[model samples]
Target: MAVALQTLVAEAERYLASAKIHDYCPNGLQVEGRAQVRRIVSGVTASQALLDAAVEADADLILVHHGYFWKGENPCITGMKRRRLSTLLSHDISLLAFHLPLDVHPEVGNNVQLARLLDITVEGPLDPTDARVVGLLGSLPEPLSPRDFARRVHEALGREPLLVEGEQMIRRVGWCTGGGQGYIDQAIAAGVDLFISGEASEQTFHSARENGISFIAAGHHATERYGVQALGDYLARRFAVEHLFIDCPNPV
Candidate 1:
């Protein structure tokens, strides 16, 4: 079945409330393609590899978490950017990307989907007063040692996470998918026994150590893989269009 490109974009923007969120990049449709979309390809990032794979799959539209035209990036579309945009234009594949919207969504957000995958009972947002931060606070059904929790994350994400073991057993947990290690302090202030993020900074180690809380840096790509897939599935079910999620493995 095929759906009009405009209709799909409108529904996606409305579902994610993209206009209300302030993101580093514009949300929703970034590139125009064919008038109708029959098949959708979703991925964590819209890299050249993904575009190539989508072309091979003959996708009508490409949905991704990361897209071009950032807040501070160079305006000129040259080199890698030129190639990426050219691919989309040449193939007539629309590019629809959602960044913070995808991360903060209550149902299909990266953080929420990750919690489900790891069996964490969500309590609430990591920072109650701040609406901008999408990190979450949750608890395991039972306390597990830091190493054990790391093992669980590894098993679930199929990647060995970097763990900073603390002295206490892990019961209360906090996490943000992708490059959200900056929220470690916010998680610490929330009194979580452990905090997990996709990438960690140098100060993150000191903060975790000084605060005496466990920390885990799961691979950025691994942690953020689920949300786009879930969103694609939802769109597929809603519009009766085919959806394919392609994972170009990134060790980072």
Candidate 2:
């Protein structure tokens, strides 16, 4: 039994509403397509290649982490943008996107999933005041050597982590999945011994050294790919819709 497009969209939208996220792009149903969705495809970005793949799969809808109409994007429908949207519109494929909402959903969020994989117990949001804190602070079940924890992260995530060890053991850690290096200060203020994010900047080294917080930079796209995938699986099982996750490599 397939789910109606309206129903699925409503579920996703309601989920977003509950989170109260501040999103750069709109949260749900960026493009309208068939009224009924039997097959759904999800990916990290709505790139030209991903749209083509969705079309090939005869996907009724495309779910992505990064959708169109970003804050700084030109409103005009030009080269790359035109190509991506035109393909979906022509195919009558609906587009549903959840950015920060997907990152902080607690049950299906990227950060939550990453923490679960690393066996970290979430204490609270790194930024308590912000309702949509993308990062979380947590403590390890048992204290592990920094090197051992690094190896565990690499093995679980299937990618080598960039590690900067601090002076103390990492019992309490902070993590924000995908390009959240800017939150290192907040993590430090939260008194987490280690800060982990998907991407690293040159200045992050100084932040780690001076702040005395251990830092780890996992791959941005790699860390984030799980949340949307988990959401897709959940929807598929709950609503009996077929789903596929399209993978596109993003090294940064």
Candidate 3:
């Protein structure tokens, strides 16, 4: 049986502790839809294709990693923003978003999910105090060569990872899913031997070499797909809602 939209929102808000976010956008129910939600759709971004799919599936709610109303975006709902929101509102489809919350939740978070896939046991938050600490610190069950570790990441993500070996057998590893090369220094301070994140800056190579930590730049989209997918599956099972994870390829 389908659950009320409010019930799903309450569950997700409680699970993610929505108040903890210092987010650029509002974190929940960006657009209200039917009160009784029988079908839900999820995606990384609330793109046009995702909305089209949700509409075709007759979804009552859309959940996503990125939704509209970013901090600095123009307040007027016009152009692309207008179209996205208009479609959902017109179709009576609710939109629910979990951003940093989804990224930081210990069990279903992006970093933790990646760690689980790589056979790494999490130690703790990469930045313990930061609410936006999407990075995680962990260790391999046994130390693996840089090459071997890189292979593991590739196989797990099904995409070739960019590796910068820094003269260390990778046992303690640090990871932040999605464009988190900025956290390399944090990983270094935490005594990690290898740091992995989706996407890297040019300076990352120099920083990794100098800091004595091997680095891996996995694709942003690939690394982030897991957490949201897991969340979608959980919702489907819990509410018996028809949940579909819309995939939109992004190389960066």
Candidate ordering by lDDT (highest first): 1, 2, 3
lDDT (tens digit, per residue) of candidate 2 on 30-127: 99998999999999889888998999998999988888899987899999888888898899999998888889887989998899889999888989
Which candidate tops TM-score?
1
Q: How do the predictions measure up, each by TM-score?
A: 0.99, 0.94, 0.93
> After superposing candidate 3, which stretches have Cα over 4 Å from the reference?
129-132
Model 2 spans with C-alpha error above 4 angstroms: none
Better of 1 and 3 by lDDT: 1
Model 3 residue 45 distance off true place after TM-score fit, in angstroms: 1.1
Root mean square deviation (Cα) for candidate 3: 1.6
For candidate 2, report its TM-score: 0.94
lDDT of 1 by residue, 159-222 (tens): 9999999999999999999999999989999999999999999999999999999999998999
lDDT of 3 by residue, 32-55 (tens): 999998878888888888898889
lDDT of each: 0.95, 0.88, 0.87
